[model samples]
Target chain A: MKVHLFIPCLVDQFTPQVGIACLKLLRATGHEVVIPTNQTCCGQPAFNSGFREEAREVAYHFKTIFHDAKIIVGPSGSCISMLKNHYRELGLIFPESVQVFEIVDFLSQYGQSLRFHSSPQRIGIHDACHALRELKLYDQPRELLKRIPGLDLVELNDGQACCGFGGTFSVKMAELSQDMAREKVKTIQAADVDTVVSLDGGCLMNIQSTAEGMGVTLHAKHVVEVLADAMISTGEQA
Target chain B: MEFTPRSIKANFTESLKDFTLRKNLTKATHHTIEKRDALKAAAPDWNKWRDAAAASRRESLLHLDRYLAQFENQFTALGGEVVHATTIEDARSKILDIIKAENGRTVVKAKSMVTEELELATFLNAQDIETWETDLGEFIIQLAGEHPSHITAPAIHKNRQQIAQLLHEKMGVPYTEDPELLTGYARQFLRQKYLDADVGISGGNFIIAETGQVILVENEANIRLSTVLPRIHIAVTGVEKVVPSQQDYANLMRLLPASATGQKMAGYVSALTPGVSGGPERMIVILLDAGRRQMLASEKWEMLACIRCGACLNVCPIFNRGGGHAYGSVYPGPMGSILTPGLSEPGNAPDHAFASSLCGACVDICPVKIPLTKLLLQTRGDVVNTHHKSWDNLAERSVWKSWSLMMRHPGIFRIMRWFGARIPVRFHWGSDARKLPRLAKETFLQQVRDGRFD
Candidate 1:
């Protein structure tokens, strides 16, 4: 299968490692991975902030870019959801068969083929709100991590609660957003884990930044990066 | 402390800093949520019940005018009076006229958000008709000269000690923090008003149009006393509360208590028909249409299906931290944010819709499946389209315009990322709490060009 990689803007500019990890992991699963170099974003920031025209304009661009792909997968849950759920929501004329999936949801299918043998570490999971509610990819990501040899997954209490990095909401209600982040980090800490893995890079960014600001020694990593690092492989992209 | 929805940003700043308020809100909301979740987990058909309720609620909304007329006819045929009020002022004056005509002197009230919308107590007291809030939470807030913080739990922001102090100081009762003793004090005082009062005023959880019965649900039993013990009863409810039939109302009833307070059933559920033996002979239902018809005509009419469950508020992360007071409206939290802007004109609570992070927890927990987060985002667009004078928005619009253009062109996006990463920048907003992510030294586009993934 050919997997058209959709790297969200945040991952591309800031966390290219996540995008590369996704490319490596998709390759590990015996698939051809192609990075659509023009793919900038799924227009979540503008759409969420009430700029419909901008969101629509960017969304049409997205549709034009990836509408023909067999399967498009992204490293971030929120970004993938924007492509899946938001086109119709914005009243934009979108095709029904864009076929987009979050990395975990896509990779979970090739479980037997892909191998992860990460060193032993107990980690908590902060599933993104969009992935949990919109895409309904709740246990799929946890299931992927579970098969990793020696990777102990502890689900945090109040795991359903949002991390409050609502794109522009983080900037508009910065203090409140950070407060929510701090609270979530503490919950992850309560599970007695220093490292927390999440499905969305946006959430991990908020969690990581907020934890650092609070002077808390909590490491936040995306699930793709964690799994990609565990297996030795020739990282190749078509 | 005095604030309006327009001042929400300012209001939440104070609310967020108040440790005591945060503590009270967290304890109350969490306890309700836990109880509600427990009740839901035990029910095998909770989702099925929700679907039925949503269908019924939508059925009524689709035929709002027809059902409202049917409701008026059925109630009037049974000797109940029906009055229509298009605005808040109109509703207030009509209530005054009814009291004046009946020579009613005092009012004993139950918990009603509509009455809070009408500011009934303030108006009636100014008219020299003694008005008392009989619901314990309502009574506490009334005594404190404050508004109801939460829709169902009016005094949810107050701790027991603060409530005890309010009772001791305002009601001339002895100070005590004991919950039962506090209830007893409220009960003892309210019992007399129900007997002596000439009229009772309450809000309906639902009105069965086919049966012409006004339904009231409460844990305090104050509604029972308020509706039955007075000579005249006035149920001030929104026009949207009417369901087409008893069957529809019953489906909604199953979810209300569970969603509102996590109870299997309220302590009292009064189905008041005009001619019930112990009930008031002169029954008047003030069906309020304060901007609902406009909502029905608009794209946001799905919001009218809200059952005032407060489940959305309990689950909202913003409401969890900021508390309901920050909304600065009679209706607070997720549902309130949508309703406040949709039900009213722009500039009233312009920021309410924007305050949300668009986390779909409220959407998930809403009994009627209102799609609150979607509506919140849509309502944000409404706010932007309607209220455009914010100089901040003028600047924001251009930023997003540039961002969209940058997204359309990969070359521009790459250059922007190049600058964005090396800038070592702090955003003017939220910088106090957040730090920018360090950009990848070699962009992923560059990484691919360099054969890093080869």
Candidate 2:
């Protein structure tokens, strides 16, 4: 299968390692992957903040860039959701044959042949709101994570709650955002896990920063980074 | 007691300083969520009832005039007076006229969000008519001379210590943090008021058009007493509460208590019809349309589908943290986040729509299945377009505008990334508590193009 990788702008700028892991995972699963360089943003930041005209402009540009791909995949659940769900709000449509998948969903469905070596780490998973509620990708990420041998997936209490990284909300209502992130980190800390894994880069960024600011030395990694590490240990990296 | 000119952000900052309020809110909301989820899980037909209730609301809202008129006709035929109030002032004045005509000096009110929205209690107090809140939580807040925080649990933000203090100061009761003792005090105090008040004012959970009946659900018997004890019973509710049939009301009954307080059925679910032998002789049903018709006409018309069960509030992270007073509206949380902006002027509560993380928990827990998140997003669009003159909004818009330009062209995006990643661009907004993610030296596209992956 040919998959077009949609690396969200946050991943493109902030955590390209997540993008690299996504590409390696897709390749290890025996698929042709293409990263269209013209793709930068999915216009979600503008769209979520009510700037529809700005979002519409960027969304149109994004559609043109990814028009040729039969399958679209992204490391971020929210950006994928923006592509798959919110495009119709602006009257934009992808081709009927084209489908978009969050990275975990793509991997869980198509990467069954792929395997990982032992990492022996206790990791907690943070379910991003859009991914969990919108895309129903809760179990997919967990299922993929469990496939990595010797990985103990720690259960996060109130794991589905928002980390308060709401695009404009983080800045617009900074106080509430920080409070919520602190609350989420406290829950993760109580779970007594070594690292927290999330599917959305935005949420990881918030959790990572807020957890660090509290003088808590907790590692926040995207789920793919953990899986890619195990894959590299087993000599499965493409 | 008064609707102050406080921004949601400002109110939130103040509320955050109060640790007791935060602890109380978190405890109360989490308790309700657990019970609500358990009840939801136990009921096999929960989704079916929710769908039926949602469909009924949607259909009635689309034909609001028809259902409302049907209710008025049937109600009037039964010797009930149905008043169509176009504004809060209209509703208040009409209600006061009813009380004045009845020569009422004191009134007892059950939990009513519509009356709160109308500032009915404050208006009556100013007019020298004593008003008593019969619900324990309402009674507590009323005594404290503060606005009710939560819709259903009006005093959820108040700990027992605060309530005990209020009781001691206002009611001459000894301070006791025991829940049973406090309830005993309120019940004894309000029992006399319910018997003495000349008028009874209550909020209806649903107005059944087919039967001309008002269905009131409560764990306490105050609403039941409020409807029956006084000679004049005035039920003030938003026009959106009217459903076409009793069956629809029954479907909502399955959801309301379970979602609001996580009960299979409220202790008292009264389907009261006026002119009945036991109920009040002079029943006044005030149907309010304050800004509801405007919401009905817009693309975000589905907001009228709200049943006011308040499951949204219990599940909202923002509401749980900031408390209801933070929103500074009669309604709070996700439902309030949308409804406050829909009903009020654009500038009033303009920031309410942006107070959410759009987590969709409210939508998931809503009894009537109102798309609260979508409605909130639509309201945000309205707020941005109408009140974009704020410096924050202006700067935000400019940033998004440049973001669009930067994202559309890869050449500009690449150049910006190269310099932007190196330069420490710290937004002082939340930068103190949160450090921004550092940009990677090279993007995945550059790495792939450089034959690193091949």
lDDT string, candidate 2, A1-238, tens digits:
9999999987877788998898888988888988887788888988889888899999999999988999999988889889888898889988789989998898888888777888888999889998888889888888888988899999899899999988888988998899889999999999998699998988988998898788888988888999888875235344
lDDT of each: 0.86, 0.87
Lowest lDDT 10-residue stretch of candidate 2 chain B? B1-10
Per-residue C-alpha lDDT of model 1 across residues A81-125, encoded as one tens digit per residue: 887888788776545555778989988876457765556989899
Clashing pairs in 1: none
Question: Compared with the true structure, what per-residue lDDT tens digits does model 2 show for residues B1-454?
Answer: 2345437788999998899998999899889889989988998988898889889999999899999999999899998989889998899999998889889999999888999998788899999999988988888888888888898899999887888888999989898899999899999988889889989999888898898988888888999898899988999999999999988888888888888888888899888787889788899889999999988988778988988888899999999889999888889999998888788766667778889999899888888778887788788788778867888679988998898998898899888778886786764438475777666778888887788877
Candidate 1 Cα misplacement greater than 4 A, ranges: A232-238, B1-6, B424-433
Pairs that collide, model 2: none
Tell me the tens digit of each residue's lDDT in model 1 across B10-45: 777888889998899889889998999999999999
